[model samples]
Target: MIVRCLEIIHPDGDYPVAEFDGIRVGGVYPVLEMVTDDDHCYIRVLGPDSPDPGLEWDPVSFETVDTRIPPGWTLAIAGGRTRLADARWQRPGFWTDYYRGDPQARADYDHVKSELLAAAPPREN
Candidate 1:
């Protein structure tokens, strides 16, 4: 997914951070994934200098530019072997080792993975 920054609201309390990291108003960013809690949604996107699992930002600050799911992505429920805070849209292989030693969970994961692949759109040559 892609998003464009709509605004930058500064932190109010005595928070350690005082800036929006690398996020800028009007700047477009590629979202790695989105997570939600009881009341708010957070998007994970790369900062100007952060690598890999990037920083999570409030979804209210950005506008959705695209909602297309990338190839090889799958939804992971937060349970069993998964350590996610909530259900997540994640890249393939994100479940590695999480199901280890649990036959039923592993089987369930394999089944879901197969179904996801089968439902994916065909790749262009």
Candidate 2:
């Protein structure tokens, strides 16, 4: 999904930080993942650095540009079976690289990616 930032809110603190790094108002971003709790929803998008999914931001700060869910996406409970947060939407292979030491995780990631891609529409030239 794509979103356009509508505002930037800087949290008050004495930690020497002002605003979210690499994020600016009116900036458009592609959402890599989304999570919601009982009160609010958040999204993670690629930052100015590209490739790297930046920090999560409250959904209220942005407006949805594209609501289409890309292929290889799924909704699962965040924090696994321990925490009871709302389900999260994530892209396939999102957790693959995070678990480099776990063979099972890698296999699961590959399987999900393959299955989703096979069922997705062909790319337009």
User: What would the per-residue lDDT of candidate 2 be over residues 10-119, giving only the tens digit for each residue?
Assistant: 74542323236666677676666677767667776544543333567778888987777766565665443212111221434435654554565555544543443344
Q: How accurate is candidate 1 locally (lDDT)?
A: 0.54
Residue ranges of candidate 1 with Cα displaced over 4 Å = 12-19, 79-125
Q: What is the lDDT of residue 11 in candidate 1?
A: 55
Best by TM-score: 2
Query: TM-score for all predictions?
Result: 0.53, 0.56
lDDT agreement with native, every candidate: 0.54, 0.55
Any runs in candidate 2 off by more than 4 Å, and if so which? 12-19, 78-125
**C-alpha positional error of residue 89 in candidate 2 after TM-score superposition, expressed in Å:** 9.2
Q: Give the TM-score comparing model 2 with the true structure, all chains together.
A: 0.56
Q: C-alpha displacement of 38 in model 1, angstroms?
A: 2.1
RMSD for each of the candidates: 9.4, 7.5
- lDDT tens string, model 1, 1-125? 56777776765653433236666677666665566655666777654444434567788877877676645445554433322221332434544633344554455444544443354344211
